[model samples]
Target: MKIVILGGLGNLGSQLAQTLERDHELSVFDRVDFDVLDENALLNILKDIRPDILINCVAYNAVDNCEDKKLYETALALNCELPARLAQLALQFNFLLIHYSTDYVFNGLETKKEFSENDTPNPINKYGESKFLGEREILKQAENGLKYYLIRTSKLFGPQGGSPQAKPSFFDIMFKLSQDNKELTVVNEELSCFTYTPDLAAATARLISSKAVYGIYHLINEGAVTWYEGALELFQLLKQKVAVRPIRSEDLTRPARRPKFSVLQNNKVKKLRPYQEALREYLNNL
Candidate 1:
């Protein structure tokens, strides 16, 4: 299979390219080499390559910053418009479209019930709204005979990507803070599962290779945890003796409203290994 990965230098995209390069003809595009949003360049590349699969890993994920009107526009353009455009191309070129969505799409109100792929999205924050709109755009294309797999996952962490704007994962940030600061505070709220990029990339390959029936799927690492709990586990794994203070979500003023419990349930496919296992592997590698 000939695969083209947009935003290929970013965290998830980098892992996906690495995972698939040996098995498939892989073409990767990063912002450094080419502006992925440049319609003309992208169209020409697609025309020349006519890839069997086009994977979009670009997203505007500055959650709090997205509350600013200007950033929100950028977010919508990247998160929604870009995917919409790719979905159109997927239909026209007859290729499989693989786009990633987020767990933030849920309201987080259904704490007792985990969110399944079948659940309707009701995003509560600007960032979540933008991602949900992206999902809607792809769904519209699917209605128009677009073959696609909408994978919704959350709390991605692992090796850093080449994107300058790519922020380090929560684990990295917390670890860094621990190094410099005597005390570290992490939010003990907003529960969600963590995803390892390599694990996700591997699962994506299996899903595609198996020719699995897909509509919307959740490919997240198993288990749910609050940011504070996650931080504790992370510190424990590193065997770092740092004081981790628990903080409430309301204690800090943020631009975006986060879901209290947006744990995604993967009832559609095989469950991923627990995040603890993935996190250990990541730490060992580093």
Candidate 2:
């Protein structure tokens, strides 16, 4: 199978591309090569490659920045419009389009229960709203003879991505803060699964192979933890001496409001593998 990954230089895209490259013919496109907002370039790439699978990893992922930007115009263009158009092209060519979504679609009100595919989306911020809009557009296009998959993941981190320096992810940020003896404060009130990029890529391979199940699927590592707890664990693993303090979400003033508890239920994807085992393996590698 031939696969093309948009935003291929990003953490998840790069990992997925390399992982699949061993088994399948893989071509990756990053912002430097192709712009999602550039419709002509996108169309040309789609036509030239005519890939069997199109994995769209491109996204305007800055959570708080979305609040200040022209929410719909900036984010919707890439998130909703371009993907909708791409989905149409995929349908025309009888190609499979795998689009990535987010767990922020939920409002985090349902704390006791893990969010499932059956749950309704109620995004609380512009970022989440834009992502949900993209999902809607792609699903609508898929409805008309387009084969597609919307894999929703949360808290993605991975090895040196496309960056020359290969800086750390959020977890790495916490790790560095601890290493520097800086005071680290994380929001304990909020909870989520800190998914590793390698794990997500492996599961994505299985998902594309299964291709049997379609629509929205939640994919995350096992063992959900709060931001503070996650930092503490990572610090523990690194043997770093950073004091991690817990705080409430309200303590931080941000442009956008994140879901208080956006723990994605991976039972749908867990059938592919035992997530606990996968999580342990990833952490061990780290």
**C-alpha local distance difference test of each model:** 0.93, 0.79
The local lDDT score (0 to 100) that residue 19 gets in candidate 2 is: 85
* Candidate 2 lDDT over residue span 60-94, tens digit each: 77788788767547787877777788788888877
Q: For candidate 2, give the lDDT of residue 20.
A: 94
- What value does the lDDT take at residue 54 in candidate 2? 90
Measured by C-alpha RMSD in angstroms, how accurate is candidate 2? 2.3
Worst 10 residues of 1 by lDDT: 107-116
Candidate 2's C-alpha runs over 4 A off are 163-167, 271-286
Query: Across residues 1-286, which tens digit of lDDT does each residue of candidate 1 receive?
Result: 9999988989999899889998999999888877777889989999999999999999999999999999999999999999999999998899999999999999897565899999999999999999999999999988888889999999999899887877799999998898899998889999999999999999999999999885899999998999999999999999989998999999999989999999999997789999999999999999
Each prediction's TM-score versus the true structure: 0.98, 0.92
Displacement of residue 243 (Cα, Å) in model 1 is 0.9
